[model samples]
Target: MTFKSINPANGEVIASFEEDADYALKIRLGEKSFDRWKNTGIEERIKLILNLAVILEARKAELAKEISLEMGKTLKSATAEIEKCAITAKYYCQIAEEQLGSIEVSNYAHKAYYKYEPQGGILAVMPWNFPYWQALRFAIPTILAGNVVLLKHAPNVFMSATTLEKLFIEAGFENGIFQNLLVGIDKIESIVADRFIKGVTLTGSNLAGSSLASLAGKYLKKSVLELGGSDPFVVLADANIESAATFAVKSRFQNAGQTCIAAKRWIVVDEVYEEFLNKVSEKINKLKAGDPFNTESDFGPVARLDLAEKIEGQINFLVKKGAKKLINGVRKGCLLTPTLLNMSRDLSHSFTEELFGPVACIITAKNTDEAIEIANETNFGLGASLWSQNLEEGEHLLQKLNAGSVYLNSMVKSDASMPFGGINQSGYGRELGVYGFYEFCNVKSYIIEK
Candidate 1:
């Protein structure tokens, strides 16, 4: 069977490609490349990684267009995503030497140090959201650390998967240093268990994370899982309501509300609830849902038709549980207008479950205590956004909020300069930054004799 990539905007077929059935061959290739690459000088790797940034910029338009068509991301957002990926790749190159270098430690015998050694080939099972960014950020760091990469990108973005492979090749990397295999999900378990694959990192749903985590555990291989996030955007009464509402609208609706760390729930203090709601609702109404490639489009289609169905289904569940829609939802195929909802908090799936599309829910809290409570209520402990003019209050609340990363008076976004990941069901392990650059490396200690 052919793997088809359909454009969500107009329901057109972007392209169709054959899935790579030669998993063993690719695994062998990755293993061989890792053996040779692990001994390759860090300076060379850094140079190649920096070259990727140059190439990404040169082909920004093409890459962004592919992402926009494959995943229904607005052209503007898609371009921004590519730029962010390029920046991340280069940043990782800048810090790889220091981050992956050996560190000295005191030992009684003589001298001791921590050695960061590459184990072998690493597998990256990435999601379609942020198609290029998510995959590149993972692969670049792993490969730079001297381990080869086997990317098992989401099948929906097969074209993107191949493009990324070509990207690394064009950057003067040797064959198999970074390879993208167009394979089905069913093959991932054995690939993770393969003796050649040293570790696995996945960025996808909780269900997928669980399956891959189990396989990695069963085989005693290291695994990093970055799963779903139903993050809360907390707005306090003392906050700048106008700025809070504006950011809320941006955080929730950007990318058609498909981001893992996007503010899914808006928790507001009662004193400013009405004002915040009115402010955000008006902006939500102004969102333009149209062709993704169009410059004027603000909201594009959710990746696929089924995703839109899931969004609609969740909204229906919430409305049945006494929740009310603040704005009438306009949905056509994969295109959905920004939806503002007043959550009833009735034990409904919509209240607790994650809505992965252009849907935003509002929950009012009487005070800061209630706001904190509502923020921590979700099963997902990913990134969160806190809106408050009082820096001291937001700083103190940081320790109280149950999330991996919390932004103060700003939107939560992944940066190569900082560690990005989540806690609880949002999954374990971190990615990006110095902390993540060494996730798949062997942090070993050895003492020298005098």
Candidate 2:
């Protein structure tokens, strides 16, 4: 089926792309690319990615505008996302050699070592939220490790997908090192089932991740799925309410709250709940939501109309379920107002479900034990944040939180230096850091007798 990507802000058609490749063709292309890319050394792959990073840095303004226009992210955030892509690419390039190099081990047996080798080809089903960054995070490492990639990007960000393909080509990459497949969702199962695709990686919703994981399991193909999150932003009684509130606004409202790692649930101790809420409300009120191209704007429209509607539905559902609305919801075109709900009970649908927008659900607890209980109640365990005046207290709570990463007095965000992934229904495997690079590699142990 052919789909057209429209501007979420005004419902204007931005571009229409046809589903172009079938399973057989995708398999053939991937196989062909693998033969060439797999033979290319890590140093050569690093050079190609470094060239792409340079190209991205030079055209940051142009690429950022395209991303903001197509996805409705603020120009500033879009630019930052673009810069992140470049930085990630350069990071992988700089470390590919050392990270992927052979490792030596000294033991009782004569000589033993291990070599990190790449898988043949990987199928990447990327989301549009952070269009450029998500794609690069997967592509750079996989390619640097000598693996070719087949990208099936979200339909809404087709232009960015095509632009990414062109950037690789311009960077002097061999044909097929990275190819964008303009295919519909129906074709994904067949593509994943293809023998040429050694593995799969996805960054999307929980349902999407589950379905893809099931398919990958059917074929016993390795997969890394990074799904939705209801990350908890905990504020202890002894914490700095003002500082915590400032970071809370950034964690919740950044990217219009489209981030998977974005802090969705705020669990504040009753002792400081009033002060924390006041400071957070003030910060949210000060944010400017308007045209993404406007320099003064701090927020932009939701990625699409459907998403905005979903956000509205979630907020209204909470209100109808008897949750007190501290800040009422608002929508203008595709833009959704920042909303905060005071959820008193553990209503199944209240703050438990993932609401992918600028809505923060505040749950009050008497102490740290109650706070940790509420945080672990959700099925998602992507990431969580804890705020406390005592560093030891924050670290202690961090150990109890059932999440992949925990931050102390900071927002939950993915960094190249840190491993990023989720536990439970948030999906499996990881991305970023040395562990992420090793995710796509086959660690082969070699033993030599003296």
- Badly placed stretches (over 4 Å) of model 2 are 348-351
Candidate 1 regions with alpha-carbon error over 4 angstroms: 347-350
Candidate 2 clash figure, as a count: 0
lDDT of 2: 0.87
Model 2: lDDT of residue 74: 90
lDDT of each: 0.87, 0.87
Give Cα distance to truth, residue 440, candidate 2, Å.
Answer: 1.9
Candidate 2 per-residue lDDT, tens place, 380-417, comes to 99999999989987898799999999999888889888
TM-score of 2: 0.97
**Residue 189, candidate 2: alpha-carbon lDDT:** 90
**lDDT at 57, model 1:** 92
- Tens digits of per-residue lDDT for model 1 on 1-450? 578899998889989988787878989987878778999999999999989999999999999999998989988998898899888887888788888888998758588898888899889999998889898888888888888999899888999989999999899998789998888888888888789888999999989999999999999999998999988899998899899988888888989999999988889999999999889988888889889888899968999999899999988888787778888787899999888888754442235577898889898888999888888887889998998888997899988998999999998998888889999989989898886678999988888896
User: TM-scores across all candidates?
Assistant: 0.98, 0.97
